[model samples]
Target: MAGREATNPGDSAILVAERLTRVLPGEVPVTLVQDASVRIGRGEFVIIRGPSGSGKSSLLYLLGLLDRPTSGRLLLEGEDTGTFDEDRLATTRLAKLGFVFQFHFLLAEFTALDNVQMPMRRLGRLDEAAQRDRAAQLLRDLGLAGHEHKRPSQLSGGQRQRVAIARALANDPVLILADEPTGALDTKSSANVHDILHDLTRERGCSVVAVTHDMAFAQGADRLIELVDGRIVS
Candidate 1:
């Protein structure tokens, strides 16, 4: 999020972050995150909840590798990410992480299938035929079977979010980081998105760490990470 981005291998943990902190430089430095340590494991659903400006998004960004921490060590799959250069960080993000946001961020003119395949294309791990097949299957699994050819503009809000979820799952990353994935949806749609995200953990053995204000979703998480004033609290 606007604020600013651990995992380890073994015992199903995909990320292990130890005392991560991010500071925004200024005349008076602003600390967006402080001493935030967390572990996200395979097939685990973790929820991050905090008031606005409380560093919830900042912490998520740090965990997701979208932002570098000023200090602290983060290990992803047992590799120390603290030493990764910008190019390596970008490559790592593309290869090992997926993201979802309130806006979906789908290409305006591309079909749902194309959007889902974008990550696979960028990673170039599979040939075109395999990419298409995986993308189509992902959409279908996300309940967009007949709508693969439809563009984001043609789909409903719920459908668009489903497409985004499929796209997030495109690379089959170990962890999926989402910020307000249901922030723009109707009540029913919100519930659907929540359920879909929750199901990913059980069905796909994928870890999910979401920043949300929805208590219903938070309550169902395997763990709820609470943040206040840039610090984790009970």
Candidate 2:
């Protein structure tokens, strides 16, 4: 998190959220994120920390364009997302961002290579051969070289998670938003996943914003942001 030669987070920002808020409406409205402003620079690894119900996942969802903010605005790579329609938002997410979650979410019927190729196929940037080649390479990079033909059921938990990581990187996304990516892994796998996310910043110059309860994970981040009761706290 520290080796990229520091720059102001707002300088050359890849994603920026200004006073972003998401509120669920009803007779009694509940606010999940309140006036949250965050800036992530290229090659930066940022960690979001808070206890349960502290709005960490809510804030991440907004930043990752999975949920719309009720107020304020969000920008990714300098373009405002506040006005994008659902289709446009989905397209942007497909092209510019990658995601990982606590669950691998692999298709039960697909092989590891096929699962990783799905995103590239959706984006349509690569031809079928290229997609297969890139997916295979990604799996190899993640140490799943021999398992490319195997389905999720055939792999171990760590191996499946690594395959998930490969799928996230399938399109060479500039930013990755991960929600509890290591939550289900053993300690060794957790460390391995952490190092991979960290290396993406140091080695690939890709930014990462992750939600996690692990303080050890936070210790390696360039920025550790904490929220309490839906608001950022000192």
Candidate 3:
């Protein structure tokens, strides 16, 4: 497998799908994603937009390797993903991908710092002190320094979401997949989240592929892909 080129930030495609499709069992199998093909390069900010039942979320799941395609092939970092077993896929996801969803899935029982450190702890690469340090640093980087010790319930919606972002970065993933990450926040918080995503792509050179229904949000991405009826319409 070839690693993405380190030349122009957007020159190397980090994620690629060829004739990708997903089938769901019904009376007859229904193809939710139909012959979809997409290539998102490193540092690219790509938005997947669509109406309800248009398969936007389905497409995102495939890209994030959370769901397997029923047909065609997917390549991550130029490595064919079809051959990978579930364990290999899990490892790849842990090492290469980060995700932020519409809701902040922070553990309410834990403080923001503890929640952010969960991934590092699972990976077991850092000692206790090192994990704490990295978690605190990530929260600080996401502008949640003051909220580290606070529980999710004590923090504002925006702050909680920021903590989730920090948690996503805990593994330093090469790609971030966000499913309406700011959908639950106010306009201000949404903007803040948007800015953080953009900064990650532009500054840290991470590829960001977001699934959104907000036109305002989609317009800001480097590329906007429209999915309708399980296919790319634009």
Candidate 4:
């Protein structure tokens, strides 16, 4: 994979991980990520790719602040997150980061519009009407315009994923972390999701970091980080 590198991957980065590592304690402790360092710039589409158990998703979780690193540091938009408490971390995640998983994870019972509104409601940045407007616009932008009232079960696989993307964008996050976002879709649907995410960087000025096994998806990224046994490989 070939793509442009940031002129200054650190000073101007949207997300930076330095010597990040994660370990799970048990009878025999397991290390999921080891000494990883990387920087993602604004509007960059980055792909984290490796074989199974290479810690792709683990690294994403660490970057997204969903899990703490056993050691090392993460900086979001040049702010060090090492000292942030759980509540602060949650707040930061909700405000500055968005996530899309392989599973759409849309609430089956909720309409697509309601699902997108959930994040904005939690963030409380907008009133109910404003939230509804934004959610509707996001869905429309993702080609789900008239489908907003439909439940996840009523939509196609691709439409459901688009709804998931809209939900991820509800809070207007600067960094979007996607873990196997297209893993469950067919070829055409996968391409659609791929184009939407890649377009986000250029069109919306949002950074995207996706963990994927699909080389086709990674090929379109602005940068690629390959991992082997939890370590980034040159």
lDDT by residue for model 3 (1-234), tens: 111221223468888888788999889998788888888888999998889899989999999999999987999999999999999998888888999999999999999999999988888888989999999999988888788899999999999989998988888899999999889999899889999999999888998999987777776788888888888877
Clashing pairs in 2: none
- Predicted candidate 4 versus true structure: per-residue lDDT over 118-208, tens digit per residue: 9999999999999999999999999998999999999999999999999999999999999999999999999999999998998999999
For residue 220, give model 3's deviation from the true position in Å.
2.4
Give the poorly placed runs of model 2, Cα more than 4 Å off: 1-7
- What lDDT does candidate 3 reach at residue 145? 75
Q: Give a tens-digit lDDT track for model 1, residues 1-234.
A: 221222233447789888888999999999999888888888889898899998989988998898999988898999999999999998898888989998889999899999999999999999999999999999988888899999999999999999999999998889999998888888899999999998999998999999998787676888788888898884
Clashing pairs in 3: none
Scanning candidate 4 in windows of ten residues, the lowest lDDT window is: 1-10
* Every model's TM-score: 0.94, 0.95, 0.93, 0.95
Tell me the deviation in Å of residue 233 in model 3: 1.5
Predicted structure 4: clash tally: 0
- Candidate 1 has what TM-score? 0.94
Clashing pairs in 1: 5-61, 5-62, 5-63, 6-15, 6-16, 7-14, 7-15, 7-16, 8-15, 8-16
Give the local distance difference test score of model 2: 0.88
- Show where candidate 4 strays beyond 4 Å: 1-11
Q: Is candidate 1 or candidate 2 better by TM-score?
A: 2
With candidate 4 superimposed using the best TM-score fit, by how many Å does residue 180's alpha carbon deviate from the native?
0.2
Summarize candidate 2's per-residue lDDT along 1-234 as a digit string, tens digits: 111221344548998888888899999999998888888898889888888998999999999999999988798988999989999999988888899999999998999999999999999999999999999999998889899999999998889988988898888989999999999999899988998899888988989999998777677788888888777773
